[model samples]
Target chain A: MRINLASIHVDDQEKALRFYTDVLGFLPKNDVPMGEHRWLTVVSPEEPDGVELVLEPDDHPAVRPYTEALVADGIPFTSFAVADVHAEFDRLKGLGVTFTQEPTVMGPVTTAVLDDTCGNLIQIAAMEAPAS
Target chain B: MGDVFKALADPTRRAILDELQERNGQTLFELCTRLISKHGLSSSRQAVSQHLDVLEAAGLVHTRREGRYKFHDLDTSPLRTITDRWQLPTD
Candidate 1:
């Protein structure tokens, strides 16, 4: 099964959409009417038509506590694969993205961690060659 | 229609992941055998296959097609997305 997208609830839809699309280069995949809240989503250009990131509205009662607890506990909600951690890290840094961790070698893979400003610690990594 | 949380929201998927954490890598049959009995699940092979499909689509798991056996393992890339999206401070 191929995952098409990951979803995150946001306090401000427009602001979050801008950060994801304008700042991170994800293209809008879905933006349609959904009662009071619009069904919005985005996808990475690099993985053309790959996973879609669903931008959910944080109107639910659990959102505030969920987002706050995750941040307070320093728990990363998800991760992604990258061809090159250093390059991606540098490129994002150039864009003024604040990183909480630098690239570092870990056992079989080299990885770097960054803050998405949206309340998550995204990791970029270069996976080791497939086990022979 | 993917719920975005379609694959992850299930406790079964989470359990499958917890199992993967220990095994790291396993074929579909292996995972089923190992987990089926333990979880007391009464699903057919097709049902497990469907679940695996969801997991694969979510990018939470990776599968490599080998001759007759498809090897599966956890893919942590989307985990970064979850982490970043959650903005968890790792100090």
Candidate 2:
């Protein structure tokens, strides 16, 4: 019933690992060998037990067209929930992460989109804290 | 095309995936029935088929033909990749 795992198909695992960890600050969770491709995963250091993001290889026949079309249309592959989108945006920008959309406020939520450098655009979003 | 995010982004598609996960192997008719009865989804056969095609492209689903019946199964390896990447402290 509870959700735990999610995946992001990357063009290259090693390169994706570097961007996800070095730039995004996610902690490496798993790195099991799977022949040519290793079974890899990463966790947000802030929420270690929250959920795992899989860094999968985009070797499947259907993946390329799927990713390319989205990229061409300027769509984010998936979004991550953040405590503060603005702060995370600034922090990530400082680390040379390229952003497609700057922090934007829309009623109850704030969001920003960035390129993962692994052939996908990712979004970071946050909800406004309710007033007491 | 099998965009994992695009495949997963839709509520109906997610429901279809859930159906396959709960029951490993099911024919198209069975899936359509369960989706309507259990999830109250009112999509047409064509719509469900299209969604299944999307999921298949995303590698979330696998299919095989046995005799006259084609059955669908949730591969689940892709799901594991997501969770495995963000592993627990057991490492």
On TM-score, the leading prediction is 2
- What fraction of the genuine interface contacts, i.e. the true contacts, does candidate 1 reproduce? 0.00
Q: Give every candidate's TM-score on chain A.
A: 0.81, 0.92
- In the order shown, the candidates' DockQ scores are 0.02, 0.02
RMSD of each: 17.8, 19.3
Q: Write the per-residue lDDT of candidate 1 for residues B1-91, one digit (tens) a residue.
A: 2333678887777777876776665555445554565666656666776887888888878877533224678875676666777888779
Interface RMSD of 2: 16.9
Q: Could you give me the TM-score of model 1 versus the true structure?
A: 0.52
Docking category for candidate 1?
incorrect
Which 10 consecutive positions of candidate 2 chain B have the poorest summed lDDT? Answer: B63-72
TM-score of each: 0.52, 0.57
Q: What is the lDDT of residue B20 in candidate 2?
A: 75
The native-contact fractions of the candidates, in order shown, are 0.00, 0.00
- Which runs in model 1 stand beyond 4 Å of their true positions? A129-132, B1-91
CA lDDT of each candidate?
Answer: 0.69, 0.80
lDDT of 1 by residue, A1-132 (tens): 776768887777778788788877788889998888889998878876788888888888988788665543233456678877888888899999865445655456766655566655555778766767
